[model samples]
Target: MVNHKKRRDLTTRSVLIVNFNNDLPELEKALIPLNWECASACDLKQSLRIIEQKNISVAIVIIQAGNELQVLNVVSKLQHTTPDVKWLAITTQYPIPSPYLKKKLATLFIDYYHTPIDWGLFSNSLGHLWGMSKLQIESKKEVREPTLPQELVGCSEPITNLKKDLKKVAIVDNPLLISGETGTGKGLCAQLIHAQSAREKEPFVIVNCGALPSSLIHSELFGHEKGAYTGAERQYIGRIERANNGTLFLDEIGDLPLDLQVNLLNFLDDSSIERLGGNCPIKVNCRIIFASHIDLENAVAEGAFREDLFHRLNILRIHVPSLRDYREDIEMLAQKFLARFAQDDSNLRFTNSALQAMLQYDWPGNVRELKNRVLRAIVMAEQGKITERDLGLKLTNNNMPKATPNRLRTEIDTETLLEALKRNNHNVSAASRQLNISRTTFYRLVKKCNIQW
Candidate 1:
């Protein structure tokens, strides 16, 4: 036994001693000089209750020669229930234990001490365990509470409604379908849902169905065994497998080939999938979120998409509004993008005329287009203030298009369309005639451009 004349301050530290024996008093006496607090329990049940009631970070279990089995059983239960609590062991007999028992003890405890323990070494080990426990707690806190990226930047009514819906949907684990026009940030909405979900700490994988090559879409989604196909060098784990225990965001889901849609539907029906070449079914636990700009109902009717698959995916739906629907947020969004792109150029500001032009012009490309224009203007603007001209907007009242005969015939110029609309007093039929395009084509352009009357 060792003794110290000077008492060190360690009131903040706590340890639980289970099955304490005659040696416990000596240990307590040694710890008291270090100002360490100790709680003792005669049984595992009592120890568990004490652990729950106290903020003890370390536990020391004492084992007698014949009571090894009892002590080991109790320690195993405690280890499962309170994994965060670091454990140490003290035994009266050492070399007499069975090999299995010895292994079990070694595996469970950070360190073990036999009879005639070194008091100095035991004290240092306890301090080390406490410090390690603190570090692990801090690390878990950082992982569980992360600062997510800022993607949704608007406070408009539509945006507010969307946020409310997201909060409600996040708590429930189900397949979500997001429908909107192109560039409406459906992918971002998927990301927001996953970030707020219970599985936030898990993986969030994205797959652009439209971007993947038709020949490889199946392989990419369902993975492939080694030598399953030509040019296959090694086994591949698909996106769905990669997202297990988390979320799988499939953007432009409408573009998935009809043949593959059936396979996807089967996977959705039963949370299991068969790899491209493998015969065995692999179970995957991932929340599926699908996004499509095209109308799935129309696609189903046209035989371009499967009706059953469409209905299955449409169970939990969210429709993101086009940028024009929330015009109130355009200025704020523009300013936010300006700040992002301007960087250290603090003096850079959008002119009143530039803001007015942004409000008046139809943003067909939605938020994506706005971001692009703002980024372009920041690089192109010569003066401190970004003007309407810098954003490629005509200063005239009608904002008519400057004639460009060589421009693509399929491309509908913003100025030309706006001038036609103004000339026809926003009459859809007359505007279509003025542009010399069919009514359907004209209306599509209007919708595509996000033109608002």
Candidate 2:
């Protein structure tokens, strides 16, 4: 038995005891010395009600020798209802008779004690379980704090409007279609919707339709039974099934093949799917959020995409704005990225010229491109300040005279211009920024100078 004087702190800690066959007195006597409070439930149903009503970190289940099957059923339901609570089982029989019952016992209990209980050891175990449960609860709280929708990180009017739309969409369970240019944070928008939804605690599974190979796409999205195909070795759970009771984000929805689109539409309509080579239909409950950079409407009109499927997914829609449209937030975004990626050098900062260049450049790749440039600059910068040069922006004379209103007559050195173009990976927007000339002027200079690499 635990020393009564040493366990004065246990008075505030309570444990729920689910008794079968009036097995509470001995356990009560053992726990009393530790100054612990106990709540008793005669059956599993009552125990579940008690758990729902109270704050329970641990449970003690007293089981009779012959009622293992009943006990197992009750315990299984109780475990699912109060998954955070740690359960400790006590059996009167030292050796459980059946192998199946013993296996079930192992699966249900976090720890167990035999009838001729070692009171001291059991008390110690309870304390350990309580400590672990508290730690786990705190860890979960920490994880949830960072995933809030405010982390989406934009302040422009388009971003503000999008956030409002996300909040409205999150309240109702509906299939959502998110359309945006590539790298315009469509995936992030889907994540925000999931985080803000009622199913935030459940899984958030992402499927990149474009990245999956055509041959494996069907099996990958809908799963496959063992021996379903030539390479099958084991049964696999598909993304839709895995996201049951949560959210499923399908990125690059336009890239999903026409045949697979039919299956997807069926699943969306019925909330069920049939595995490859499996006859039975399995039901899944998950919110669907589809993202597409391509013009899906165009695909439908061109007969490349199904019109019916497009209409089904177009129920609720959100259009994420490109970074160019929200240029006001660039500096804020750069600072946020710098804070994340420049932890090793707290003093590092972006120079005014660097910020100016960033504002001037048309980010064709959107936020993704900005993040990449900022990350690269953090690594490549040596003077503690990130400059336009560090970000691959060149300084050119913008005041150069033009031979014609729509053309350039200034003779830009061919080798110098080619070097700048090569440095910027031949990206016209970036190359023009480096040369400090307008994109139109740069194009005309290239044509007039007849520069070719």
Candidate 3:
């Protein structure tokens, strides 16, 4: 367990670090407000004890590529034992080559610093994560346990807003139309929005509009009466009725035939449906959530999707931003996936360089591609840290990340400081209050950074 200094010695600004690699100078340099300095964990058991005892809000890890399994174990423990603690990885730049390390690291760890830690960006991401932790505490009433919303992870501004949007749409009963590129997690977003809604308690029925054959479309959606047609064995419940008082998720809604679209449009407009060969109109009290990889407007122009149906579902539209657009979340999301399902669940971790490589790619498949690489690393890697090699990603011949460097650069310190200041509303005194430091000390540091008064 970490040794606790007096309340005065370790204030609200205290941050706990878990590093198997001993680098006192780097660790100390990372600390702000010496009194609220970082705490070290000697071992996994010791780390858990320290985190539990100190109420450590953030953890920084300098993971060894070889001991990937041990690192994963420590990370897993941190996630559960200190559910609220912010985690950061300070490591060598990517090309890490271990599958065990890749999968485990991707699951929960957020943010990373390449060799010669980019102090500015590192500080910012850390502060952002810290701000999120504070928000989790202060807005406990508004906060719900995060459940991997839209496959977008991290506390970046864009993802945070998307999360808010998901929550807002979850409460209403309006039809939600989620539009995103293929494999960008439209179905997942639909499920998330549904889970957050009033209809979450009821059955969540999923229908792959494109996959359902034409002959069975009507019966599958509205069910059929006993002996309704040649193969009708008995009365069957349709996807619409089955999802009564719940959510009906229509995946790939663009592929639904025109006639079936009319039927679906009728149900959406009137909440009533009649089964094939059945006389009674069954009333359904449910919400419809739909996903489309293609542009509905273009489809409508081609006389494919019904314009009316599109308008109805578009009432609460949410367009999930591709991972490439909000690039800050790449490493964080990669780490989250790595940690959740790695083979060497305990010892596997990602090398910093590997994360840098991950951040460089323009994810055409978005989260899905990221997931595939991490999964591949988990199954194929042999080293402790999973690297770009393990992820099977190669840099362009020109030796640069696929995208421009600016997008890959994350401002760490400013982000963290701003988040802290925002949480405390630029009040140095209030910020100092949490760090258990004197206001004068806080001002001196703020002055050092030339931060506005």
* Model 2, CA-based lDDT: 0.77
Error of 1 at 107 (Å): 51
Please give the distance, in angstroms, between residue 434's alpha carbon in candidate 2 and its true position after superposition.
22
Q: What's the C-alpha lDDT at position 41 in model 2?
A: 87
- Ranking by TM-score, best first? 1, 2, 3
Give the CA lDDT, 0 to 100, for residue 224 in model 1.
94
- Find the candidate with the highest TM-score and give its number: 1
For candidate 3, the per-residue lDDT at 388 reads 80
Q: TM-score each candidate.
A: 0.57, 0.57, 0.56
Q: CA lDDT, every prediction? A: 0.77, 0.77, 0.70
Judging by TM-score, tell me the better candidate of 1 and 2.
Answer: 1
Q: Cα deviation in Å at residue 436, candidate 3?
A: 51
CA deviation > 4 Å runs, candidate 3: 1-152, 397-453
Tens digits of per-residue lDDT, candidate 3, 1-453, equal 223424443345556777776754665665563334567875666775465445567787877657566776667655653467888876563765676556655666876665776566666777778778877854542223345443446687777888899999888888888887655767677778877787767777888776565788789889999999998989998888988988888877887889889888888888999999999898999888898866799889989788988888788898888777888888788878887766346588888778777777666557876876686576545657787887877645454345535323223223434555665645544554443233443443455355664
Instruction: Give the worst 10-residue stretch by lDDT in candidate 2.
Output: 400-409
In candidate 1, stretches whose alpha carbon ends up further than 4 angstroms from where it belongs are: 1-148, 395-453
Q: For each candidate, C-alpha RMSD in Å? A: 24.9, 22.6, 23.1
